[model samples]
Target: MKKLMLAAAALALTAGMGLAQDTVRMGTEGAYPPYNFINDQTGEVDGFERELGDELCKRAELTCTWVKNDWDSIIPNLVSSNYDTIMAGMNINEERKKVIQFTQPYTPGLPSAYAALAADADIKGGVVAAQTSTIQASHVAESGATLMEFATPDETVAAVRNGEADAVFADKDYLKPLVEQSNGELVWVDGFDTVKLGEGIGMGLRQSDNELKEKFDAAITAMKEDGSLNEMLKKWFGEDSQLFE
Candidate 1:
Protein backbone atom coordinates (compact mmCIF):
# COMPACT_ATOMS: atom_id res chain seq x y z
CA MET A 1 0.00 0.00 0.00
CA LYS A 2 2.87 2.41 0.77
CA LYS A 3 4.60 1.63 -2.57
CA LEU A 4 1.35 2.17 -4.50
CA MET A 5 0.75 5.51 -2.72
CA LEU A 6 4.25 6.71 -3.64
CA ALA A 7 3.71 5.86 -7.32
CA ALA A 8 0.43 7.80 -7.38
CA ALA A 9 2.01 10.86 -5.74
CA ALA A 10 4.87 10.80 -8.27
CA LEU A 11 2.42 10.68 -11.17
CA ALA A 12 0.46 13.62 -9.74
CA LEU A 13 3.64 15.67 -9.40
CA THR A 14 4.60 14.99 -13.00
CA ALA A 15 1.16 16.05 -14.17
CA GLY A 16 1.39 19.28 -12.22
CA MET A 17 4.74 20.04 -13.80
CA GLY A 18 3.34 19.39 -17.25
CA LEU A 19 0.41 21.69 -16.56
CA ALA A 20 2.77 24.41 -15.46
CA GLN A 21 4.55 24.22 -18.82
CA ASP A 22 1.35 24.62 -20.76
CA THR A 23 0.30 27.73 -22.66
CA VAL A 24 0.41 30.91 -20.57
CA ARG A 25 -2.49 33.26 -21.11
CA MET A 26 -1.28 36.85 -20.80
CA GLY A 27 -4.05 39.20 -19.73
CA THR A 28 -3.93 42.86 -20.71
CA GLU A 29 -6.24 45.83 -21.02
CA GLY A 30 -6.27 46.40 -24.77
CA ALA A 31 -6.64 50.14 -24.28
CA TYR A 32 -3.63 51.76 -22.64
CA PRO A 33 -1.04 52.62 -25.21
CA PRO A 34 2.60 52.85 -25.36
CA TYR A 35 1.75 50.00 -23.00
CA ASN A 36 -0.93 47.79 -24.61
CA PHE A 37 -3.66 48.49 -27.09
CA ILE A 38 -5.56 46.98 -29.95
CA ASN A 39 -3.92 48.00 -33.18
CA ASP A 40 -6.75 49.04 -35.47
CA GLN A 41 -4.56 48.09 -38.40
CA THR A 42 -4.02 44.54 -37.19
CA GLY A 43 -7.14 44.23 -35.07
CA GLU A 44 -4.90 42.50 -32.56
CA VAL A 45 -2.97 43.43 -29.44
CA ASP A 46 -0.09 45.79 -30.18
CA GLY A 47 2.22 48.34 -28.55
CA PHE A 48 4.89 47.94 -25.89
CA GLU A 49 3.45 45.23 -23.67
CA ARG A 50 2.52 43.13 -26.67
CA GLU A 51 6.01 43.31 -28.09
CA LEU A 52 7.73 42.86 -24.73
CA GLY A 53 5.39 40.05 -23.67
CA ASP A 54 6.03 38.06 -26.83
CA GLU A 55 9.76 38.45 -26.38
CA LEU A 56 9.56 37.43 -22.74
CA CYS A 57 7.60 34.33 -23.66
CA LYS A 58 10.19 33.48 -26.25
CA ARG A 59 12.98 33.81 -23.71
CA ALA A 60 11.06 31.84 -21.10
CA GLU A 61 10.24 29.13 -23.67
CA LEU A 62 6.58 29.43 -22.72
CA THR A 63 3.81 29.28 -25.30
CA CYS A 64 1.67 32.32 -24.60
CA THR A 65 -1.42 34.04 -25.96
CA TRP A 66 -2.90 37.44 -25.30
CA VAL A 67 -6.19 37.78 -23.43
CA LYS A 68 -7.97 41.08 -23.15
CA ASN A 69 -9.66 42.02 -19.88
CA ASP A 70 -11.07 45.26 -18.58
CA TRP A 71 -8.65 47.13 -16.35
CA ASP A 72 -11.05 47.25 -13.40
CA SER A 73 -11.41 43.46 -13.26
CA ILE A 74 -7.89 42.53 -14.45
CA ILE A 75 -6.58 41.58 -11.02
CA PRO A 76 -9.76 39.74 -9.99
CA ASN A 77 -9.71 37.78 -13.20
CA LEU A 78 -6.05 36.94 -12.72
CA VAL A 79 -6.68 35.61 -9.21
CA SER A 80 -9.70 33.67 -10.44
CA SER A 81 -7.55 31.99 -13.11
CA ASN A 82 -9.26 33.71 -16.00
CA TYR A 83 -5.69 34.31 -17.17
CA ASP A 84 -2.26 33.19 -16.10
CA THR A 85 -0.56 36.58 -15.89
CA ILE A 86 -1.34 40.28 -15.95
CA MET A 87 0.68 42.61 -18.23
CA ALA A 88 -1.77 45.48 -18.02
CA GLY A 89 0.68 48.13 -16.82
CA MET A 90 -0.09 47.12 -13.23
CA ASN A 91 2.17 48.63 -10.60
CA ILE A 92 3.77 46.61 -7.84
CA ASN A 93 2.73 47.73 -4.40
CA GLU A 94 2.24 46.30 -0.90
CA GLU A 95 -1.56 46.46 -1.07
CA ARG A 96 -1.57 44.27 -4.21
CA LYS A 97 1.19 42.02 -2.89
CA LYS A 98 -1.25 40.74 -0.26
CA VAL A 99 -3.36 39.12 -3.00
CA ILE A 100 -0.91 38.29 -5.80
CA GLN A 101 2.77 37.91 -6.55
CA PHE A 102 4.77 40.29 -8.74
CA THR A 103 7.69 39.62 -11.01
CA GLN A 104 10.58 42.01 -10.50
CA PRO A 105 9.72 45.35 -12.03
CA TYR A 106 10.13 45.46 -15.80
CA THR A 107 10.22 49.23 -15.87
CA PRO A 108 11.41 51.86 -13.45
CA GLY A 109 8.79 53.84 -11.57
CA LEU A 110 7.03 56.06 -14.11
CA PRO A 111 5.49 59.37 -13.16
CA SER A 112 1.78 60.05 -13.13
CA ALA A 113 0.77 63.47 -14.44
CA TYR A 114 -2.35 65.57 -14.69
CA ALA A 115 -3.67 66.82 -18.05
CA ALA A 116 -6.16 69.59 -18.66
CA LEU A 117 -7.38 71.99 -21.33
CA ALA A 118 -5.61 74.92 -19.74
CA ALA A 119 -2.37 75.13 -17.76
CA ASP A 120 -4.19 77.00 -15.00
CA ALA A 121 -6.92 74.40 -14.49
CA ASP A 122 -7.52 73.72 -10.82
CA ILE A 123 -6.47 70.19 -9.91
CA LYS A 124 -6.40 70.28 -6.13
CA GLY A 125 -9.80 71.82 -5.50
CA GLY A 126 -11.67 71.20 -8.75
CA VAL A 127 -12.98 67.94 -10.16
CA VAL A 128 -10.34 65.44 -11.29
CA ALA A 129 -11.10 62.39 -13.39
CA ALA A 130 -9.28 59.08 -13.13
CA GLN A 131 -9.93 55.50 -14.01
CA THR A 132 -11.78 53.62 -11.32
CA SER A 133 -9.73 51.42 -8.99
CA THR A 134 -6.46 53.07 -10.14
CA ILE A 135 -3.76 54.68 -8.02
CA GLN A 136 -4.54 57.98 -9.71
CA ALA A 137 -8.12 57.82 -8.45
CA SER A 138 -6.90 57.06 -4.94
CA HIS A 139 -4.47 59.96 -5.14
CA VAL A 140 -7.16 62.30 -6.37
CA ALA A 141 -9.52 61.20 -3.61
CA GLU A 142 -6.91 61.95 -0.98
CA SER A 143 -5.64 65.17 -2.56
CA GLY A 144 -8.77 67.11 -1.57
CA ALA A 145 -10.07 67.10 -5.15
CA THR A 146 -13.50 65.88 -6.15
CA LEU A 147 -12.74 62.53 -7.70
CA MET A 148 -14.71 61.39 -10.73
CA GLU A 149 -14.07 57.79 -11.57
CA PHE A 150 -14.49 56.36 -15.07
CA ALA A 151 -14.58 52.83 -16.38
CA THR A 152 -11.70 53.42 -18.81
CA PRO A 153 -8.67 55.67 -19.26
CA ASP A 154 -10.16 57.18 -22.39
CA GLU A 155 -13.22 58.19 -20.41
CA THR A 156 -11.10 60.09 -17.94
CA VAL A 157 -9.54 62.09 -20.79
CA ALA A 158 -12.96 62.62 -22.30
CA ALA A 159 -14.19 64.01 -19.00
CA VAL A 160 -11.60 66.77 -19.31
CA ARG A 161 -12.40 67.56 -22.95
CA ASN A 162 -16.15 67.56 -22.32
CA GLY A 163 -16.03 70.03 -19.45
CA GLU A 164 -17.09 67.33 -17.00
CA ALA A 165 -13.83 67.59 -15.08
CA ASP A 166 -11.14 70.16 -14.71
CA ALA A 167 -8.30 67.67 -15.15
CA VAL A 168 -7.44 64.02 -15.67
CA PHE A 169 -4.64 62.28 -13.88
CA ALA A 170 -2.89 59.33 -15.56
CA ASP A 171 0.52 57.92 -16.35
CA LYS A 172 2.77 60.49 -17.93
CA ASP A 173 3.89 58.01 -20.57
CA TYR A 174 0.32 57.35 -21.61
CA LEU A 175 -0.62 61.05 -21.56
CA LYS A 176 2.40 62.47 -23.41
CA PRO A 177 1.35 61.64 -26.96
CA LEU A 178 -2.20 62.73 -26.28
CA VAL A 179 -1.06 66.16 -25.17
CA GLU A 180 1.20 66.48 -28.20
CA GLN A 181 -1.49 65.35 -30.64
CA SER A 182 -4.17 67.52 -29.07
CA ASN A 183 -3.12 70.44 -31.34
CA GLY A 184 -2.50 72.60 -28.29
CA GLU A 185 -6.05 72.00 -27.11
CA LEU A 186 -4.82 69.84 -24.27
CA VAL A 187 -1.76 70.51 -22.12
CA TRP A 188 -0.11 69.34 -18.97
CA VAL A 189 -1.52 71.06 -15.92
CA ASP A 190 1.02 73.63 -14.75
CA GLY A 191 2.18 73.69 -11.13
CA PHE A 192 0.92 70.12 -10.67
CA ASP A 193 3.89 67.98 -9.79
CA THR A 194 4.01 64.52 -11.34
CA VAL A 195 3.90 61.73 -8.80
CA LYS A 196 5.32 58.22 -8.78
CA LEU A 197 3.07 55.83 -6.98
CA GLY A 198 3.81 52.21 -6.13
CA GLU A 199 7.16 50.58 -6.84
CA GLY A 200 7.08 50.05 -10.60
CA ILE A 201 5.16 48.20 -13.27
CA GLY A 202 5.52 44.42 -13.02
CA MET A 203 3.73 41.32 -14.19
CA GLY A 204 1.16 40.06 -11.67
CA LEU A 205 0.72 36.38 -11.01
CA ARG A 206 -1.36 34.37 -8.59
CA GLN A 207 0.27 34.00 -5.17
CA SER A 208 0.37 30.25 -5.72
CA ASP A 209 2.17 30.42 -9.08
CA ASN A 210 5.75 30.87 -8.03
CA GLU A 211 7.12 28.72 -10.85
CA LEU A 212 5.47 30.82 -13.53
CA LYS A 213 6.56 34.02 -11.83
CA GLU A 214 10.16 32.85 -11.75
CA LYS A 215 10.11 32.16 -15.48
CA PHE A 216 9.01 35.75 -16.18
CA ASP A 217 11.36 37.29 -13.68
CA ALA A 218 14.25 35.49 -15.29
CA ALA A 219 13.17 36.63 -18.73
CA ILE A 220 12.81 40.24 -17.57
CA THR A 221 16.26 40.17 -16.07
CA ALA A 222 17.74 38.79 -19.25
CA MET A 223 16.10 41.56 -21.22
CA LYS A 224 17.44 44.21 -18.88
CA GLU A 225 20.93 42.78 -19.00
CA ASP A 226 20.90 42.60 -22.80
CA GLY A 227 19.62 46.18 -23.03
CA SER A 228 16.70 45.02 -25.16
CA LEU A 229 14.31 46.18 -22.49
CA ASN A 230 15.71 49.70 -22.53
CA GLU A 231 15.51 49.88 -26.32
CA MET A 232 11.88 48.82 -26.26
CA LEU A 233 11.07 51.36 -23.58
CA LYS A 234 12.50 54.16 -25.65
CA LYS A 235 10.69 52.93 -28.75
CA TRP A 236 7.32 52.93 -27.07
CA PHE A 237 7.65 55.52 -24.31
CA GLY A 238 10.06 57.92 -25.99
CA GLU A 239 13.75 58.51 -25.26
CA ASP A 240 13.10 60.17 -21.91
CA SER A 241 11.66 57.03 -20.25
CA GLN A 242 13.60 55.68 -17.28
CA LEU A 243 15.96 52.77 -17.95
CA PHE A 244 17.02 49.86 -15.75
CA GLU A 245 20.55 51.22 -15.37
Candidate 2:
Protein backbone atom coordinates (compact mmCIF):
# COMPACT_ATOMS: atom_id res chain seq x y z
CA MET A 1 0.00 0.00 0.00
CA LYS A 2 2.17 2.85 -1.25
CA LYS A 3 0.42 6.20 -1.08
CA LEU A 4 3.71 6.91 -2.88
CA MET A 5 6.44 8.98 -1.24
CA LEU A 6 8.42 11.37 -3.42
CA ALA A 7 12.23 11.43 -3.60
CA ALA A 8 11.99 14.36 -1.20
CA ALA A 9 10.29 12.26 1.44
CA ALA A 10 12.47 13.67 4.23
CA LEU A 11 11.47 17.16 3.16
CA ALA A 12 7.79 16.48 2.49
CA LEU A 13 5.34 17.08 5.31
CA THR A 14 1.86 17.99 4.39
CA ALA A 15 -4.07 18.93 4.42
CA GLY A 16 -7.64 19.59 2.91
CA MET A 17 -10.22 22.33 3.56
CA GLY A 18 -13.95 21.78 3.27
CA LEU A 19 -16.22 24.76 2.52
CA ALA A 20 -17.93 23.90 -0.67
CA GLN A 21 -14.32 24.30 -1.62
CA ASP A 22 -14.22 26.51 -4.65
CA THR A 23 -12.23 24.59 -7.21
CA VAL A 24 -10.50 21.96 -5.12
CA ARG A 25 -7.27 20.96 -6.84
CA MET A 26 -6.87 17.27 -7.71
CA GLY A 27 -3.16 16.48 -7.99
CA THR A 28 -1.92 13.52 -9.99
CA GLU A 29 1.07 12.06 -11.85
CA GLY A 30 -0.52 12.33 -15.25
CA ALA A 31 2.01 9.99 -16.88
CA TYR A 32 0.47 6.82 -15.40
CA PRO A 33 -1.91 5.70 -18.05
CA PRO A 34 -5.43 4.36 -17.30
CA TYR A 35 -5.06 5.41 -13.67
CA ASN A 36 -4.18 8.97 -14.71
CA PHE A 37 -2.59 10.39 -17.86
CA ILE A 38 -2.62 13.50 -20.00
CA ASN A 39 -5.04 13.13 -22.88
CA ASP A 40 -3.11 13.71 -26.09
CA GLN A 41 -6.13 15.23 -27.82
CA THR A 42 -6.81 17.87 -25.18
CA GLY A 43 -3.39 18.07 -23.56
CA GLU A 44 -5.22 17.74 -20.21
CA VAL A 45 -5.29 15.08 -17.54
CA ASP A 46 -7.64 12.15 -18.19
CA GLY A 47 -8.15 8.61 -16.82
CA PHE A 48 -9.93 6.63 -14.10
CA GLU A 49 -8.74 8.92 -11.30
CA ARG A 50 -9.78 12.02 -13.22
CA GLU A 51 -13.28 10.69 -13.66
CA LEU A 52 -13.53 9.32 -10.13
CA GLY A 53 -12.10 12.48 -8.52
CA ASP A 54 -14.57 14.70 -10.33
CA GLU A 55 -17.50 12.66 -9.13
CA LEU A 56 -16.22 12.57 -5.57
CA CYS A 57 -15.87 16.36 -5.63
CA LYS A 58 -19.43 16.70 -6.86
CA ARG A 59 -20.78 14.52 -4.09
CA ALA A 60 -18.75 16.39 -1.51
CA GLU A 61 -20.04 19.71 -2.82
CA LEU A 62 -16.58 20.81 -3.94
CA THR A 63 -15.62 22.19 -7.31
CA CYS A 64 -12.56 20.42 -8.69
CA THR A 65 -9.71 21.13 -11.12
CA TRP A 66 -6.77 18.97 -12.20
CA VAL A 67 -3.14 19.66 -11.34
CA LYS A 68 -0.38 17.62 -12.98
CA ASN A 69 2.76 16.88 -10.96
CA ASP A 70 5.93 14.90 -11.46
CA TRP A 71 6.00 11.75 -9.32
CA ASP A 72 9.26 12.78 -7.65
CA SER A 73 7.84 16.05 -6.28
CA ILE A 74 4.20 15.10 -5.94
CA ILE A 75 4.03 14.92 -2.14
CA PRO A 76 6.18 18.01 -1.61
CA ASN A 77 3.94 20.09 -3.87
CA LEU A 78 0.87 18.85 -2.02
CA VAL A 79 2.44 19.95 1.26
CA SER A 80 3.14 23.35 -0.30
CA SER A 81 -0.55 23.75 -1.25
CA ASN A 82 -0.02 23.22 -4.97
CA TYR A 83 -3.06 20.99 -4.73
CA ASP A 84 -5.77 20.11 -2.21
CA THR A 85 -5.81 16.35 -2.77
CA ILE A 86 -3.63 13.63 -4.26
CA MET A 87 -5.69 11.52 -6.69
CA ALA A 88 -2.70 9.76 -8.12
CA GLY A 89 -3.01 5.97 -8.00
CA MET A 90 -1.73 6.05 -4.44
CA ASN A 91 -2.34 3.10 -2.13
CA ILE A 92 -3.39 3.57 1.48
CA ASN A 93 -0.67 2.50 3.86
CA GLU A 94 0.90 3.34 7.22
CA GLU A 95 4.10 4.86 5.82
CA ARG A 96 2.23 7.83 4.29
CA LYS A 97 -0.49 8.21 6.93
CA LYS A 98 1.91 9.92 9.30
CA VAL A 99 2.04 13.03 7.12
CA ILE A 100 -1.18 12.94 5.13
CA GLN A 101 -4.72 11.82 5.90
CA PHE A 102 -6.78 9.81 3.44
CA THR A 103 -10.43 9.23 2.68
CA GLN A 104 -11.86 5.73 2.64
CA PRO A 105 -10.50 3.85 -0.35
CA TYR A 106 -12.16 4.37 -3.73
CA THR A 107 -10.79 1.38 -5.57
CA PRO A 108 -10.72 -2.04 -3.90
CA GLY A 109 -7.03 -2.78 -4.62
CA LEU A 110 -4.34 -3.37 -7.19
CA PRO A 111 -1.64 -6.03 -7.22
CA SER A 112 2.06 -5.21 -7.61
CA ALA A 113 3.67 -7.38 -10.33
CA TYR A 114 6.87 -8.00 -12.28
CA ALA A 115 7.53 -7.66 -16.00
CA ALA A 116 10.59 -8.57 -18.07
CA LEU A 117 11.67 -9.40 -21.64
CA ALA A 118 11.73 -13.10 -20.82
CA ALA A 119 8.74 -15.17 -19.74
CA ASP A 120 10.89 -16.85 -17.11
CA ALA A 121 13.13 -14.03 -15.88
CA ASP A 122 14.36 -14.60 -12.34
CA ILE A 123 12.89 -11.85 -10.23
CA LYS A 124 14.36 -13.04 -6.96
CA GLY A 125 18.04 -12.20 -6.48
CA GLY A 126 17.99 -10.40 -9.84
CA VAL A 127 17.99 -6.72 -10.78
CA VAL A 128 14.52 -5.21 -10.64
CA ALA A 129 13.39 -1.69 -11.40
CA ALA A 130 10.62 0.30 -9.77
CA GLN A 131 9.53 3.92 -9.58
CA THR A 132 11.43 5.79 -6.89
CA SER A 133 9.78 6.10 -3.48
CA THR A 134 7.18 3.46 -4.30
CA ILE A 135 6.26 0.34 -2.35
CA GLN A 136 7.53 -1.79 -5.19
CA ALA A 137 10.94 -0.23 -4.80
CA SER A 138 10.92 -0.80 -1.05
CA HIS A 139 9.85 -4.38 -1.59
CA VAL A 140 12.66 -4.94 -4.04
CA ALA A 141 15.15 -3.59 -1.54
CA GLU A 142 14.04 -6.05 1.12
CA SER A 143 13.81 -9.00 -1.23
CA GLY A 144 16.97 -10.86 -2.27
CA ALA A 145 17.32 -8.64 -5.33
CA THR A 146 19.08 -5.59 -6.73
CA LEU A 147 16.87 -2.52 -6.69
CA MET A 148 17.10 0.23 -9.31
CA GLU A 149 14.85 3.22 -8.86
CA PHE A 150 13.56 5.40 -11.68
CA ALA A 151 11.85 8.78 -11.69
CA THR A 152 8.85 7.49 -13.62
CA PRO A 153 7.00 4.20 -14.11
CA ASP A 154 7.70 4.31 -17.83
CA GLU A 155 11.42 4.43 -17.18
CA THR A 156 11.20 1.33 -15.02
CA VAL A 157 9.57 -0.59 -17.87
CA ALA A 158 12.07 0.85 -20.32
CA ALA A 159 14.93 -0.27 -18.08
CA VAL A 160 13.83 -3.89 -18.46
CA ARG A 161 13.21 -3.60 -22.21
CA ASN A 162 16.61 -2.04 -22.85
CA GLY A 163 18.64 -4.48 -20.69
CA GLU A 164 19.35 -1.96 -17.92
CA ALA A 165 17.20 -4.04 -15.56
CA ASP A 166 16.42 -7.73 -15.39
CA ALA A 167 12.77 -6.96 -14.70
CA VAL A 168 10.46 -4.13 -13.76
CA PHE A 169 8.03 -4.25 -10.88
CA ALA A 170 4.91 -2.10 -10.80
CA ASP A 171 1.16 -2.30 -10.34
CA LYS A 172 -0.30 -5.32 -12.10
CA ASP A 173 -3.14 -3.22 -13.50
CA TYR A 174 -0.46 -1.13 -15.19
CA LEU A 175 1.96 -3.87 -16.25
CA LYS A 176 -0.63 -6.40 -17.40
CA PRO A 177 -1.85 -4.15 -20.20
CA LEU A 178 1.72 -3.43 -21.24
CA VAL A 179 2.53 -7.15 -21.39
CA GLU A 180 -0.56 -7.72 -23.56
CA GLN A 181 0.39 -4.89 -25.91
CA SER A 182 4.06 -5.85 -26.17
CA ASN A 183 3.40 -8.96 -28.31
CA GLY A 184 6.36 -11.20 -27.39
CA GLU A 185 8.80 -8.49 -26.35
CA LEU A 186 7.89 -8.80 -22.71
CA VAL A 187 6.00 -11.00 -20.27
CA TRP A 188 5.19 -11.36 -16.62
CA VAL A 189 7.85 -13.45 -14.90
CA ASP A 190 6.49 -16.82 -13.82
CA GLY A 191 6.49 -17.38 -10.05
CA PHE A 192 7.67 -13.84 -9.45
CA ASP A 193 6.72 -12.76 -5.94
CA THR A 194 4.56 -9.67 -5.36
CA VAL A 195 4.31 -7.03 -2.67
CA LYS A 196 1.49 -8.03 -0.34
CA LEU A 197 -1.06 -5.57 1.07
CA GLY A 198 -4.79 -5.68 1.76
CA GLU A 199 -5.37 -1.94 1.64
CA GLY A 200 -7.15 -0.22 -1.25
CA ILE A 201 -6.17 3.06 -2.88
CA GLY A 202 -7.20 6.32 -1.24
CA MET A 203 -7.09 10.07 -1.86
CA GLY A 204 -4.32 11.86 0.04
CA LEU A 205 -5.03 14.97 2.06
CA ARG A 206 -3.51 16.91 4.94
CA GLN A 207 -3.73 15.17 8.31
CA SER A 208 -5.51 18.13 9.85
CA ASP A 209 -8.19 18.12 7.21
CA ASN A 210 -10.59 15.94 9.19
CA GLU A 211 -13.68 17.62 7.83
CA LEU A 212 -12.48 17.20 4.31
CA LYS A 213 -11.71 13.55 4.92
CA GLU A 214 -15.15 12.96 6.37
CA LYS A 215 -16.76 14.56 3.35
CA PHE A 216 -14.88 12.33 0.91
CA ASP A 217 -15.27 9.25 3.06
CA ALA A 218 -19.03 9.72 3.09
CA ALA A 219 -19.08 10.26 -0.66
CA ILE A 220 -17.14 7.09 -1.21
CA THR A 221 -19.46 5.15 1.07
CA ALA A 222 -22.41 6.31 -0.99
CA MET A 223 -20.79 5.19 -4.22
CA LYS A 224 -20.00 1.78 -2.79
CA GLU A 225 -23.42 1.15 -1.23
CA ASP A 226 -25.09 1.98 -4.52
CA GLY A 227 -22.64 -0.14 -6.58
CA SER A 228 -21.57 2.65 -8.94
CA LEU A 229 -17.99 2.38 -7.73
CA ASN A 230 -17.91 -1.31 -8.56
CA GLU A 231 -19.32 -0.61 -12.00
CA MET A 232 -16.52 1.84 -12.71
CA LEU A 233 -14.00 -0.63 -11.31
CA LYS A 234 -15.09 -3.19 -13.89
CA LYS A 235 -14.94 -0.60 -16.65
CA TRP A 236 -11.33 0.32 -15.86
CA PHE A 237 -9.89 -2.69 -14.00
CA GLY A 238 -11.95 -5.54 -15.41
CA GLU A 239 -14.83 -7.57 -13.91
CA ASP A 240 -12.66 -9.42 -11.40
CA SER A 241 -11.78 -6.24 -9.49
CA GLN A 242 -13.09 -6.08 -5.92
CA LEU A 243 -15.74 -3.50 -5.13
CA PHE A 244 -14.77 -0.16 -3.62
CA GLU A 245 -15.25 0.67 0.11
Query: How far does residue 221 in candidate 2 sit from its true spot (Å)?
Result: 0.5
lDDT (0 to 1) per candidate: 0.92, 0.84
Q: Pick the candidate with the highest TM-score.
A: 1
Q: Give TM per candidate.
A: 0.92, 0.88
Model 2 regions lying over 4 Å from their true place? 1-20, 193-195
Worst 10 residues of 2 by lDDT: 10-19
Task: List the RMSD of every prediction in angstroms.
Answer: 3.2, 10.4
Candidate 1 matches the true fold with a TM-score of 0.92
- How many Å off is the CA of 8 in candidate 1? 14
lDDT of 1 by residue, 108-133 (tens): 99889999999999998999999998
User: What TM-score quantifies how close candidate 2 is to the native fold?
Assistant: 0.88
lDDT (C-alpha) at residue 59 in model 2: 91
